[model samples]
Target: MKLLTIENLVRKFSLKVLTGENQLQQTITQSRSHRPGLEFVGHFDFFPTERVQILGRKEITYLHKLSIEERQIRIGNIVKYHPPCFIVTAGQEGLTYLTQYCVEEGIPLLCTNEPQTTSEFITKLDAYMIKTLAPEIAIHGVCVNVYGMGILLRGKSGVGKSETAHTLIGRGHRLVADDIVVLKKLSPRTILGTHDGKTKEFLALRSVGLLNVVRLYGRKAFQDETRIALDIELTKWQKNSLNNELEHEPTFTEYMDVQIPHIEIQLQPGRDVAGLIEAAANNWLLKQQGYSAAEEFMKRLESDSSW
Candidate 1:
């Protein structure tokens, strides 16, 4: 789990501070935001106390309908829950009483200038939180989104991982990460990959020190991140080993607790490694759609006894 703090939200949105400056250090554990409509109506059942409380135009209007004394009591009761923070969107005014209540309870009150409606604010904030708080882990690999499939190139150092990824980019695929790929668990079974912030859009070849992938191949050569769909491991060609034989069942590698389809490629001089990788990606896509050429060939071979 990643750390999401009120301070992070403030910095990302440039929210105006109304009060509770001391509470900026508070953390938000859930990747969801609540609108507090039910809470405002005194319905405390199932209130997401761990999420950021968003007070949008509709909620504020409802508060304005009440007398000052009533509004203060209702808002004060919510503040007592000590939510991670309170975000007032649409830059609405007349929230002084709410601000005072938050200050009294030491709850961070933040306001955004965007003209988004109440529902819009909730949806956007929820999305932002989900992305920022997703579980992440880093690994040594090259990730590329080829034909709408994410292919992760992994192996020992100097095993032509970078060179193969570079070639795939020349074949019109987008490079997601090079050298260091950060994997984020977006859901129970999905993992997203991206380059390290400092090393994005850069690749290292054996002879070449570093090359700007985006600059050399244009902006289309770069992808911020992609859901990892397959893992390809490159290995030095073994003289007599048939490790990549079609008779062998496909294997998988555990990444962030998720099993990714894995393929081992034997590297050798005069071999079209780039083309082979591209074919592997295409074959993975076929398997995803419930088609397997190897299985089909075996079935046909069993059906026909002609030598």
Candidate 2:
């Protein structure tokens, strides 16, 4: 399992480090955030010290109402658990007691760049951590956004997967990634596809060297990420190749255990591979609307038995 370090968190959230600058490299163990409201008043039965501790205006105001000794002692007890870090939300700062205890324990103390409430910041932080820490696997495929559908072009090497995808870009489609696509399983059924940042906006061609996608196609043809909706494989047309057009009942395949609609196209000279992929994306959209072209064709054949 990958962990989110506090240093990256600060950079991501634009957080201002209030204290414990030396412990900025601490890694967050989970996406869950702790308010520690009960722990402030001597209620520490099931305190989750591994989680990121948060303090909002409500908690800060409540602490201010307490006596100096009571506040310092309670904070000391909570800091003894050594949480991954502390986030003071709602723009509240200048906490002498909490800062002292956190610095003594070497816990990174961070504040939001904006004045968002604890609930709001927690919601955003939770989403970020869940996505940033999600397990990912990079597969050898070209990801393209065809007619608003994410289509993964995959097959054996030299099958024109990248070439077909580049042609699709010329057809006004967006390119999510080329050559290598990083797929992160956001959930059991949802997988998002993106490219590695270093090699972004570039494509490799067999005949030509690396082509900058953004330079050739401009920014409209580039996309950072897209939710994968369909997967297509392109294989060289051999003599023993099977015709997939004969029978199609919504084929499917998996990436990182998440299933998506699948199609296999036989690549041959003079074949309109890019157009076929665009059609596949359109067909996938029609399936989402409770319509299947293959099913409709079969119905027509059964009704008009003039064959």
Candidate 3:
């Protein structure tokens, strides 16, 4: 698991430290922050003690409405529980309510002004945390963009993955990554594939050595990332190679728990592997639009009277 510090958070959002300067190293374990309306009303049963707490205008007003004794007891319960930090949104009054409690209790106190609203600021924080806490892993493959469909090309070394990518680039396709692809789960069903920014500028080809793809094919020949829409596994041709029969059932491979459409293309002497990959991308896009060439062929075959 990745841990975030108040130090990083302050830098990310340009937050102002009202207190707890020495506690900048404090870690934030939860992706979401908390606002204390319920806690001000003395509700503490389900309070998330580890989440960063936020104080907006409404929350500060709520604390002021309570008698000082009641407010102290209510807010005191929350501070004693020891949350990661307390953030008072800019333009909110009543810092005394949280600042004193945070300072005395050793909790970090912070404020931000750029995004003034509590809603917008919290949303921004949530977006960053969601991405930072997301599951990620690196895999061996060549990723490319053909016909706007992101394709992940996989095969054993020397099986022509790079060579196929090279051909695709020549045919005006963008190469996302070569050799190493980083896969991140943006959501349950969305797997985003990205490449090293510097490394993506070059394509390593056997014997020919590393070719500068960006220079050779110009700027449009490369992309930093693409959503992995389909996967293609290339293999050396053999007598027992996968049959060319139409697949009525879909095939898939799991990456970050996302089931991406997958297909296997056998490599043969003088065969066009790049063209096949392009066709596979086109086929996948067509399937997404509810049109399948294989299904059409099957329907025609079944409609025929001849056995």
**Index of the highest-TM-score prediction:** 1
Q: Candidate 2, residues 1-307: lDDT per residue as tens digits?
A: 3668999889988999989888887778776788998898788888888888888999888888889888888788788888999888888856887888878888888888786778888998887887787779988989988888788999998888889888988999988898889998888988889998876998889989898889998998888998999989898887776655745666789877889888888988898989888877887788789987777889999989977
* Candidate 1 TM-score, true structure as reference: 0.88
| Candidate 1 structure quality by residue, lDDT tens digits, 1-307 | 5788889888887788888888788888999888888888789989889888888778888999999889877887788888888899977888888878887888888999766777776777787888789888889989999988888999999899988888888989988888899998877889889877888899889898898998898999999989888888899999988654565576899877899988888999999988988888888788779988878988899889675
Clashes of 1: 0
How do the candidates rank by TM-score, highest first? 1, 2, 3
Q: What is each predicted model's overall lDDT from 0 to 1?
A: 0.86, 0.85, 0.84
**Candidate 2: global Cα-lDDT?**
0.85
Q: Model 1 misses residue 125 by how many Å?
A: 2.6
* Per-residue C-alpha lDDT of model 3 across residues 258-306, encoded as one tens digit per residue: 8998888899999988888887888778878999787798789888956
User: In model 2, which runs have C-alpha deviations exceeding 4 angstroms?
Assistant: 1-3, 37-47, 238-247, 294-307
Which should have the higher lDDT, number 2 or number 3? 2
Spell out the clash pairs found in candidate 3.
Answer: none
For every candidate in turn, the CA RMSD to the true structure comes to 2.8, 3.2, 3.6
Best-first order by lDDT: 1, 2, 3
State the weakest 10-residue window (summed lDDT) of model 3. 240-249
lDDT, candidate 3, equals 0.84
